[model samples]
Target: MNQKQLVSSALASVMALGLVSGAAAADDNKGKEKCYGIAKAGQNDCANLAGTHSCAGQSKADMDAGEWKYVAKGTCKQMGGLSLAEAKDKTAMMKK
Candidate 1:
């Protein structure tokens, strides 16, 4: 192949590898659940329902009712994890 064609082919291969790895990583979380009110500030796994931030590790407060961390599915409650409704209730109580 020509020089430009060789470079393009290499880039395409790298991108495909990245996509495969990303899919595998996503599969790793298949049994995870979003456990709210358990993550420390700046340590959440993803965005919250309240849109406080759009990415992980961006929370501004500890135990944010809206923020969540990934936990083993069906173990959220056992781990003192608050559901969205429970979190809201706790927040309201704290405010009162």
Candidate 2:
């Protein structure tokens, strides 16, 4: 095969693999829920409530109330975490 064709084929394969893995990850989260006040610094799953940043692994403190991570459904409370609303209130309180 030509060098151009080889590179194109490799890039296509990589893109396809990324799509498949992303879909698999979404499926894996079907049984999970967003559990706030549980993520440690640099361990959060996504954006925080305070809007300090917008990405995963950006938490600046442990259990910051605004930061969260995915945990098993119905297990956030057992893990000493709070719901979205409760977390929002706590975050607001922290700002006062």
Candidate 3:
């Protein structure tokens, strides 16, 4: 194939792969809930409620009451974690 066509094919392949992976991740979270105050240090799923960071695995402390991870729905409380509302309250209380 021509060089231009080859590059175009490669770029399309990469884009397709990204879309597929993103869809898979979304499906994987279908049955999960955001459970706060349960993630270990450096194990959070995404940004903390405090907005100190905006990526996964960026938590600086264990059970910060602001960091959260995906857990099976209905299991957060059983796991000693909090829902989003509860987590917000706990985080607010911690600032006092």
- The C-alpha stretches of model 3 lying farther than 4 A from their native spots are 1-19
Local accuracy of candidate 1 as per-residue lDDT tens digits, 1-96: 899999999999999999999999799899997899888989999887667579999998887788899999999999788987887787778778
Residue 20 in candidate 2, Cα distance off native in Å = 6.9
lDDT of each: 0.87, 0.95, 0.95
- lDDT, ranked from best to worst: 3, 2, 1
Q: What is the C-alpha lDDT profile of model 3 across 9-61, one tens digit per residue?
A: 99999999999999999999999999999999999999999999999999999
Residue pairs with clashing backbones, model 1: none
How far residue 59's Cα lies from its native spot in candidate 2, in Å, is: 0.6
Better of 1 and 2 by lDDT: 2
Model 3 poorest 10 in a row by lDDT: 86-95
**C-alpha lDDT of residue 43 in model 2:** 100
Candidate 3: what lDDT? 0.95
Q: What is the full ranking by TM-score, best candidate first? A: 3, 2, 1
lDDT tens readout by residue for model 2, 1-96? 999999999999999999999999899899999999999999999999878899999999998899999999999999999999999899888889
Show model 1 residue runs off by greater than 4 Å. Answer: 2-7, 84-96
Clashes within 3 Å, all models in order: 0, 0, 0
RMSD of each: 3.9, 2.9, 2.3
Cα lDDT, model 1, residue 43: 96
